[model samples]
Target: MSQVMKPSTAAQKLGILLSAAPEDFQQTPISREDLDALRENPPQWLQDLRRNGPFPRDVIAQKLGVSNSGLARGGLTDPLDADQIGELLANPPQWLEHERSVHRKVVAENERLKAERARQGN
Candidate 1:
């Protein structure tokens, strides 16, 4: 049996949103030949995506200086290009700031709890 690639993997490799892709594109099992063709001679859309990414969540979060959970809380589900991430950094909306604040608070609380637990053990 030939190796089968998941759409999620393709999305990660292509830097395109899986939801944005056509159902056939997302659902099809790309054979090794098809995979090579996609890489060697990509469609215009794929080429555009390669040049300008619909970057993965981790990349976006790092660019935005926010945690992944903060990103989700800020309601940023769609993939973003560098420009978009830059825009958020330049002028963060209220929700983005709020989510970052919440993330900081959560981290502080976790640290405090950990210290308390250590103290109780002693």
Candidate 2:
């Protein structure tokens, strides 16, 4: 039997985020055969993803110099292309600044706590 891939699984293998994908992708299960077919003869969107990349959220966040949580909090549902990321950096919104601040604070606090714990030997 041909293995069936849920939309989520397909999205992962393709290195794209589920929320970032097109609506049609979310609506169905993709069989392995169909995925193989796409791989052989890519569509425009597939080409774009391959060329720009179906980047995972972590890579996206890091490349953008923001936290993963910041991305989520900013309602960034789509995986960004390099151009999109560049645009955001060129003119970041207030929310992005706020989220970056929050992420920085959280990281600082986490480091402090870890250091404290180590000192206590627990």
For all predicted structures, in order, the TM-scores are 0.54, 0.56
User: What is the alpha-carbon lDDT for the whole of candidate 2?
Assistant: 0.79
The residue-by-residue lDDT of candidate 2 on 1-122, one tens digit each, is 88888998887777666766678987889999988887788778766765576567876787766798789988997767777777878898988888777877988999999999999996
CA deviation > 4 Å runs, candidate 1? 52-56, 81-83, 93-122
- Per-structure clash totals for the candidates: 0, 0
Judging by TM-score against the true structure, name the best candidate: 2
TM-score of 1: 0.54
Summed over model 2, clashes come to 0
Tell me the tens digit of each residue's lDDT in model 1 across 22-116: 68888887767677788889888777765566777876776666789888888899889867877888999998888777767887999999999
Output the lDDT of residue 52, model 1: 63
